[model samples]
Target: MPQDDPRDASLAVKFSPPQTWTAESVDGLATSGMFLAGIIMVTRNRILAWPSLILGVNSWINQHPLRTKEGGTPPVGNLALAFFALIASYLPLFLKATAEPAGATETQTPLSFST
Candidate 1:
């Protein structure tokens, strides 16, 4: 009878590729939480919230490694988060720029005052 080679078994185990990245389990939850928080902040018009939300998304994105199976790419969740954050953070500024002036000006006297 031929003896089984222990070295061969160990090599087989070592070389086998991992089915998935371990970070997905933790990062998925983290990304979801940040996305929810960003939505809330967007509704409230809090500009400060966008940066951290972006950071959380970036962390989740970095946790995954690009692979070559199942089309071999991570989803666009992070990119979407970034897009929404940018819109949320900048929309108010854009709207403010386009708004009508309040009619208050240093050069112009009050409406009650005559020239």
Candidate 2:
């Protein structure tokens, strides 16, 4: 019979899954989604941007430790990054909402110009 090597046990433990998702992983996915949304927004494609923004928001929400139920505290760095990505994903929409329309002209013109 072959004896079990302690080293093999350690190797097996190392290869085992943590069985829990980490905030960093979620944050990374959120960041990627935010980037994709930004790129699509740049092209003025609302259809694509909406889905990307939703993906980023979903990922950011998942970064909370409560979502994992794995007894691990949320990583602050990851939380911050994910929150930033979530906000960024909606930035274009906010800007568009606040922006003047292309056909809009200033109502208050110089008196000389009004004449």
Candidate 3:
């Protein structure tokens, strides 16, 4: 289904909702719903299925951890560690989505971490 839609373009632009929201909106809802469902499933010890689903959801959030000074006032490292775990857990899915295909036209884009 994802392969059918044009990359970076919303499916909503070309179609109207049939007694409900449009396809892109529907896809968005489905993605959100699946993510929540996957989280719930993971918490219940359903690792096999929820891991993949949660990865897609985590990529949607893409939040970065804020590191803090050591031996200062706050436990920023712990917070950052938590954030890293959250991001790491979903990294596989993000990489899969962004990875280039073999023999396909590859774009060399650099990602900036210092902001």
Candidate 4:
């Protein structure tokens, strides 16, 4: 065989055409996470916010930019929303002082007026 041309423009490795990415279960979870994050952000539910946060992180990790359109902010937005939801849910705990100390008893006395 003749020596290979050094200036050949052909790629050594063949790359298949990019196939459009279809949303599957992971995406569904991301969608549900976004929905739950919205609800959590609105309701400030601490219990449900944790799951939304977890799901948002998951979505961010699984995001595929080259395979889909509008790949810019979906994952980042989801994660941010979830983080905000978590913060919103837990922020009140830090805003006000506790009404009572743990295991403390409250004593009340009636006010008296003497004429």
Residues 11-60, model 2: lDDT tens digits: 46545445454323335665666576556645555555555656655665
Among these predictions, the greatest TM-score belongs to 4
Best by lDDT: 4
lDDT per residue as tens, model 4, 23-114: 32247888999999999978888999999999999989988766555544558889998999999999998897858888766886788899
Clashing pairs in 2: none
lDDT of each: 0.56, 0.55, 0.43, 0.81
Stretches of candidate 1 off by over 4 Å are: 1-14, 18-24, 36-38, 66-75, 96-115
- Candidate 4 or 1, higher TM-score: 4
Which ranges in model 3 have alpha carbons more than 4 Å from their true place? 1-73, 97-115
lDDT ranking, best first: 4, 1, 2, 3
Candidate 3 per-residue C-alpha lDDT over 3-84 given as tens digits, one digit per residue, 9 for 90 to 100: 5676646554765435422112223433453454445444533333344454444544542222222333222333333344
Deviation from native of the Cα of residue 71 in model 3, angstroms:
3.9
Give the worst 10-residue stretch by lDDT in candidate 1.
Answer: 66-75
The local distance difference test score of model 3 is 0.43
Ranking by TM-score: 4, 1, 2, 3
TM-score of each: 0.42, 0.33, 0.23, 0.65
Candidate 4 segments exceeding 4 Å error: 1-14, 21-26, 70-72, 97-115
Cα lDDT tens digits for candidate 1, 16-47: 65666432344564466467557745575555
Clash counts for all predictions: 0, 0, 0, 0
Candidate 1 C-alpha error for residue 36, in Å: 4.1
